[model samples]
Target: MSLKQSPCKDEIIAEAKRLGFYKIGFAKVRSVEKASASQYADWISVGCHGEMSYLDRYHDVRNNPQQLLPSAKTIIVCAASYYPAKKQSIELPQIATYALGRDYHEVLRERLMLLADFVGGETRVCVDTAPLRERYWAVQAGVGFVGRNSQLIIPDAGSYFFLGEILTSIEFPADTPLTQSCLECGRCVDSCPGNAIIGNGAIDARRCLSYLTIEYKGDFPEGFSLGNRLYGCDECQAVCPHNSTPIFTSIPDFEPSDELLSLDKKTISELTPELFSMIFRHSAIKRTKLMGLLRNLKALD
Candidate 1:
């Protein structure tokens, strides 16, 4: 990769801000050779990842970005706020705050592509779907540290956000990791109704409500209660001290639709295939599929 024509990290950061990203940081491509890597191995070994077999399949690429993009020299990590002051009523089955708005994958992709173009050369934009260790990179970039909940917590902006990244051949100065780590208050663990937080920055996915509601494809484990969640769970994040200040998103694309914010359990239970398709057309909720959603709703019964 030629350095003469490539833009600097600062210039890319400026572009990222102009595009409305809440937090941005850059890091040089490197192997994951630390406690986090070992923790991942342990998590898998203990079956903490549960039914997510993709985690096993992409183990190599997830640890080393060199495998994802051989020529990539730098990674630009970014976060966008998704917190909204208005929340769904208690009468309704809850949806995770991140999914309350339009699909973040789509929202982040458009803006990340713009930043990637500015960086020049070969580039890859990754949201959550990629096997990349996104939260690990977020910390390496100094944007934030990984909380016990296993989510990236930006000090000022909170944990209610989406993470995105740009992998490119262009080189840039890497930011130092932040000194700030989670407060270690154990709030997330105590607050989790499903008892999913198993300590050491790992979660028992079989008992995780979020994983059960969205990712796990098999039968709803008997005796596991969903606690009024129609789609995803946010009990752990809702109690985080870092998220108390409520740094709301300014991006229009992240704003929630009226139907999504007002949806009650009755509405969800009554949803027809056509209505579900039309309402969640481009939303991340589509990932669960209409039948999966109805199955989740049935658990609420």
Candidate 2:
């Protein structure tokens, strides 16, 4: 398929909404903006990425979308709220809202593939793991601004959303980047139990509770407390005043499960490998694996 001269922005956005995406934006595929690239290099150089060596391993491909899709000409970014209307027990082991239901990678990928088909083009799909700096392009696409806590904060949607993109060969006029930024509320900073927010939208993943819970492959590092979190952490987003009126997701795939909302220390401690595999079969919590969840539970205990 060849690039069309007309802007399909409205049509594409309409389809995305029909598909349940809450936010949508577009950007021409090109090298990542120099400022974002530089900041990433600095973050990695200072070892802020911690054991997530994959962030450094794919530096070139991540900086330039052309490397991932040689024929790609545009990026269609979309985000969906995962915030649930119901809250889990305060005393139970807490899980991130994003992980409460079906795995976003599965849910978002299916929707993105449908969106890609709607665009009628040669394309590639990306979720969180795909080496692409999604939040960076998401900002360029005008979906939202990078908050001080390093989350892509969409207006009204808050930061409790999942982002996915379809890299397409079809070209479209790029959306103007958003001029808005957070009010520098410092609430997220003051609220962080791990002090992971190192300011200026940068995070020391080594100290990030979310990173430590789900991404770190080893035991909890010395001096880091797991608190009550068993899978991922949402302290930064939870404290943001913008999230006070969080728009709950209508997507049933993002709803929390009964087991997740009722998970207590005893339940978690009793999880065997077999039961863990069965219960978390399609949950993002599977990313932590049984061992990692057990590790976090033990640390919190």
Candidate 3:
């Protein structure tokens, strides 16, 4: 049904803000067009996905929302700022800002469920863990523009945010997709220490530090070191000029716990599986598992 027949768009946006999302937008569910489809195929063909075989799973659904859920009529895209008010100690083992707090999969999933309830319709939520191309939908929803770094850069909040989506049978008013493009500023390309980010809005995931820390399971590639990162890396975001004025999150759940922010190499090195489980029980770091963390820490040395 059309949004006019259901909840008003303004009310939906207001509920999103009240639910702690930084921004929200809607888009019609459709297939990935020629440009996007070709780019995705090229990225995968070059083996940039690394050992993440799942990226190839559900080929149809990954490229088309209709294939994911046939009744899906619209995509409700949401963003949550994870920029921390305080930076972690330089000497401490580093975790990506997104993982400093509770797992976003949990936080966003719960919030999306609430949003679905508010909209009162058949709905499904897809966090990063899903096979869907979230940034593509975010762009279609007019929530943000893709940056040269291949990140969804929301106008005011920069790229330091997590994106989530709700696939529902109800359609909503959609904003005109943003026309802004990166200033042809090659800053992200020059700043990538691993030479991961390629041309504008394209990334070689195999060379990305974030992927290396979180998804790569075996030994570090020759000449590649973890630097100070132990779980996930944020060097690209750290250097982005757009992220200079960091947006602080007021959501209590997004705040980094003191223990996690203060974890030292000694503490991380001494961690057993059980200890790791306890420490990251509710954190996204669990995606890498204890062994992955240990592998990352050893690479740093």
Candidate 4:
């Protein structure tokens, strides 16, 4: 694709919306705030990332987006909501909302690449793999605010969105970040089944059900409780006021499969490896693999 030296922000926004992204904004590349950097350092130092050692490895690169893409003058951030049109009945074992659909990494990256081509520049697409702090940039680009649940909350759309970024050499006018923050209602903090949520968007991943179910590798910890979380938990987001009347996503790729919606305690406990692979062949839930998911079901007993 040809390089656009001065990509128009309006054109970029239009292209992003056309590509199934719900919200998009542009920001100038810069180092994250000192306080943010320090807090991350402290979080890592205290082993808040738990078994996710990758978070421990990328400090400088995460703090500096330019390191991921040299001379990256503008960062284009986009949010794609994954709120399913059909939700599972409350009687079923729970999977996190985000992993209910196709793997967002592939979906977002393919779309971002096309958007990049439209802008035409030396661009690098980041959709959850890179070390960059995505939620921070999402906030910086005015796409949303980071809620206490540690998820980026889009106004009226809730926090069920996946974020992707384009770091390009092309400079564009930066958008103003939303000045507001979450209502500090403490609903997410109180509703956390594992009590993993600390104040100020920080999570103790060691105790976080999402981390335990998806990231942790060993046997379930002693005295730990899973609370019917077969794969991941959504207690916090479920209680957040921002998500009460969520602006559901329009993307077909994010819709839940019948196989997924049909999952219940009986099916999960009887799942064979073949059935597991078939159901989650293209899902983000594949990250947990068969054993991991089966292991999580053990805690449901």
User: Model-by-model lDDT, in order?
Assistant: 0.86, 0.87, 0.83, 0.88
**Per-residue error (Å), model 3, residue 178:** 1.4
List residue ranges in candidate 4 displaced over 4 A: 1-7
My TM-score estimates for the predictions, one after another, are 0.94, 0.95, 0.95, 0.95
Give the range where candidate 4 is weakest over 10 consecutive residues by summed lDDT.
1-10
Which ranking of candidates, highest lDDT first?
4, 2, 1, 3
lDDT of 4 at 256: 90
Q: Compute the lDDT of residue 134 as modeled in candidate 2.
A: 92
Residues 153-255 of candidate 4: C-alpha lDDT, one tens digit per residue: 9887789889999998888889998767898899888888778998789999988988999999899866666877888888888899998888777788888
Model 3 Cα shift for residue 161 (angstroms):
0.9
Whole-model alpha-carbon lDDT for candidate 2: 0.87
The residue pairs in collision within model 2 are none
Question: Number of clashes in model 4?
Answer: 1
Error of 1 at 170 (Å): 1.0
Cα deviation of 11 in candidate 1 (Å)?
Answer: 2.2
